[model samples]
Target chain A: MKMKQALLTLTATAGLLAALPAAAQFQKPEDAVKYRKAAFTVMATHFSRIGAMAQGRASFDGAAAAANAEIVADLAKLPFAGFVEGTSGTEKGSPKANVWSERAKFDAGAKKMQDEVAKLAVAAKANNLDQLKAAFGSAAQTCKACHDDFRNP
Target chain B: MKMKQALLTLTATAGLLAALPAAAQFQKPEDAVKYRKAAFTVMATHFSRIGAMAQGRASFDGAAAAANAEIVADLAKLPFAGFVEGTSGTEKGSPKANVWSERAKFDAGAKKMQDEVAKLAVAAKANNLDQLKAAFGSAAQTCKACHDDFRNP
Candidate 1:
């Protein structure tokens, strides 16, 4: 039994080691694109759900709204990590050179979006539709601001 | 400024009270339909991303795989909550009435899917590709199982 347990531990350790290089975030440019896009899509999905409620187009399920807000806040941190160097190839890069060139501005826009989404999460948890609307619009503007300058149209 | 802040607080409080009179859960069947569809779409998108890696079409990004698995696990909890009562209208409801009628069976299937997805998250995080594949297939089976029985064809 002790031998079997030891073997299991060894196997588990090997598997854990396999999972990391230690992922200096992504392994490739395509990875940067795909990861960022997936995270963005998830954000959009959750945002639209809350949008429907805030707009009064759908009946607001407070719990669902709050849950989605939390997820959106969490997702807000994901995209920028994908905005690393060497992801500037024009063919695979929808993000323009300004992301790397105007680094301070791009970072500020990302920060603004994250901050706005975080506030949106707070408003959502409080069930403050008005605050949610305000924060959501703010976040959307940040998205557009960065995209307009940095993203390929 | 103090008076303006107070007035703003007052208006916000009134809006919150108005938004909730109060919702026990969802007040719209259409909300349920849209929410579930959105959750399912997110799941499908993430699964396809991982599927591409697993099938060798895309390079395996360990971080991306782990991130996606976590999202899938979170999303697993979402669609089932949307499958609440009074979501029985066939037009707005993509879920068949059997979801409400065969509630026990449906709940079990949902649980099975959630459990499998949670396992997939664990496997992905561990970088155990073999186990990830196993859990991925299990989760896919659950999707097909539930859809075959309860979702619209």
Candidate 2:
């Protein structure tokens, strides 16, 4: 019985180890670009949902609100993990070549936006509708600023 | 006022009118989902930068912070414009079927998030770091609640 248990443990451990590299392997620039862009798109979509609620374009549901909020929080952290610098170049139909050219500036812009979003996340948990309205406005500006500089269209 | 100039202007207007629809043609679901995911990834990556600053993992610079904050603001709006209800299905590695199945709930969650981020943007403009921090925390929590239910790991 002990032997069987030990074998099971080993199998699980090996499986985990194997999976780690697959996840890690995507750290390449091309892959990072793909990952980052996907995450951003999701985050952007979620933001719209939130906007509908805040602006009275739509109503809110507590359970769904909770889920959307989580998406925002995770998005806040997604960018940091994939920060392989050259990944910027691998993106297609991206804003502009300037994203890579002014990498530091772009990074800095990204960071600021995340920080603000983080703040927005916290406010959201409280369900303070007024506060939420204000925070969303802040987050939206960050998107505009980056696109204006980095995005072509 | 001149006959030739008037004719030329009319011709240009006609040409532009004809070209407009093709230029503004909505993306198909496969393309929309793909493009949206790309945008989401960028937003997520950018969010990390702000997280770093907020946690004091890094320091803040006003100009950079402001710029990134702006990016978040614009990103908030992009997803909604491109939303084609059935498009999400065409994309790979997207959230679960429930995203469309329970779209009203999902939309509510999204709206709440937008409200919070917008508030964050306003706070950022005021240069109120304390308010920013508070708002950021709230926003983060809101995002988590949604992702727990809606997103795939």
Tell me the TM-score of each prediction against the true structure: 0.54, 0.45
- lDDT (10s digit) by residue, model 2, range B44-77: 5445556666677657655545555555644554
Judged by DockQ cut-offs, is candidate 1 incorrect, acceptable, medium or high?
A: incorrect
Q: Report model 2's TM-score to 2 decimal places.
A: 0.45
Residue A17 in candidate 1 has what lDDT? Answer: 30
TM-score of the B chain in each candidate versus the native B chain = 0.76, 0.71
Fnat value of model 2: 0.62
| Candidate 1 lDDT tens digits, B28-62 | 75655555665666566567767776777778777
lDDT of 1 by residue, A59-144 (tens): 86777788888778766666666676757655533888778888888877877777677767766766767777777788778878
lDDT of 2 by residue, A1-153 (tens): 999999999999996785453345353667665766677666765677677777887675433444455567656666444545344442444646676578779878888888878877777777767777788889889878988887756
Quote the lDDT for A126 in model 2: 74
Top of the candidates by lDDT = 1
